[model samples]
Target: MHPSAFLRLAALLALSLPAHAQEGMKQQPAASDRVKEVPSIEAVGLSGLKPGTILFTDHRDDPAKPENGLVPYLDWGRVRPAERAALAPYAGYAEPDYLQTLNGVSKRRHETLKVYVAQGRFVVPRPADSIDLASYATLGFVAKMDPVIKHKTLNPADVTPTKDPAAAFAKRPDRPWCDLGTVCIESRYDLEGKLPLGVKLANKLEDGASKKVAEFVSFQSELRTLPPAETAPLAGLTKIDAPVTGGLEQTIFWVNQILRFGKFLAVFQPMPGDPAKTVVTTYMALAIKADVLDRKQEYARVPVLKNLLPAQVLMGNSSFNTGTSISAGLPTYARNRMTAFADALAKN
Candidate 1:
């Protein structure tokens, strides 16, 4: 990244520090000693939402109440024979091949990364009255990535389908990732996660434009390896994988694919005991500059760094779902880009 870009990003982030940004003369523990905050399901809010509502959050998990019993949403069993090859790249970040084969700008830089996890929930209308929420929310919408970005343009042709991630990324992207790294185009994706609707739910709605809708819902995104720092805190997240009736997975890129960025795993299921309202749990771990994670430093040499820092990663709606939008990371930055996403999912 250019030096000037970093300055702009640093300034943007300095201004973003919430009024309550943590500060204690470096009283905080070392990064390794730190813990991943996994908000409880209760704090996530389980009730009192009107049907077709999209509730979102990037709140920290309550460490004191430690959540436990979380396994991958589409653990080994959920994988099928054919999908193994196609999903290898998206789910194989832990393997040496992933880093070894990384090409273009998305290659790993060995920077200290800070991962963030967040979730969103909403209720499907009882009568299933609305646009094709599944199509809008899932994958294969590359041809229709409208209303997503403000300055950049992506060619649907560049988004070809292939199971081999190593090969795909090895090839150069025909388009630029962002405009000078400003919020102009906060983030982009390599693989889009899909949360397929079950027969019970699919039967009620009109499937949208993507013929790939069925695959999107069933396609589950996952991580092959997570830093111990991230996993240790999640060991007790018992309900982390709960209520996951269906799953999807995808990976993202930023700043001209300068970094592999991160991957996203999400699950969709009926709210326990409440068949009408559906819940979505999205988990993501991003590779962020540990320097930027420093609340006290002026660490923004990258143009788009302000889009999301270690403290508040921008995942969820904008970058993870079917397609990146024209107004991604917009309306707000700290929160997961779910507002536009919710608007798509909201039942009519």
Candidate 2:
């Protein structure tokens, strides 16, 4: 299974554990441990990020030169006005159309997309005394972004937008179904007269395929339709509760067919020696399954005339073979997002 799917399954399983078992799970290393300890921007071969400026670049000062590579860093409030303006549109969060653009790039099999990762950091100016996580949350920054962070169902057109120059491709989806996060799991739906959405969706795919293939597609289809709150086994959730916590790890699940399983994370850490300043980093990890061509050779010569076969016959199937290519661009997307977030934060 892909890592994202595995994590989703694990989360579901953990939610069903008894209270004592849940407590034991919490005792283990916090999920925050997964956050990489990036060096301060100064030590990473870069300097002079203005106190409130936000910059986005690879961990390396120069991607082509390893000797001058810089490690990831998350600190300081040095974003510039121009930069902030550039990222403002992205600051609103969950731009499904923008995500579709990245997904579109990955779908181009002829492009030979390779594994990619990018890391960046930014600083948000804080009141002089409000530096800790608690203070930051109390200030309403988290609340302002809460709804924006959740997964939103987008129109299929957003994924493959029309070419009309006058079209409005940026309009938000109406009545987007919440698929993940606290808002989704906590919301009460009026299902009184409606069939269970999951079963209704499953029955739609039960036709027109061999048993094995039908079962596979059906299962995936169901996952895309069911709310993560319903499919995931998480317990102890209340309608009034906000799943977010300062300095805690949270996940937003993507439940689209083209992109079967993926995880998006955003973390906020306090800057050292500056309690009022906070460093926020966002991470995205995606797993896609697709088919690609691989070069291979297979003998086309018949047994009786093998020795007499022409070169072309002997080289049949040598040109290319079909195989799977799983590319990861989530990290790059996350880095781009952080750059924008920093800029937007600076302006705000």
Q: Report the number of the highest-lDDT candidate.
A: 1
TM per candidate: 0.40, 0.31
C-alpha local distance difference test of each model: 0.33, 0.28
TM-score between candidate 1 and the true structure: 0.40
CA error at residue 210 for candidate 1, angstroms: 42
Q: Write the per-residue lDDT of candidate 2 for residues 138-209, one digit (tens) a residue.
A: 213332332223233333333221223222332324423232322222111111111122112222323332
lDDT against true structure, model 2? 0.28
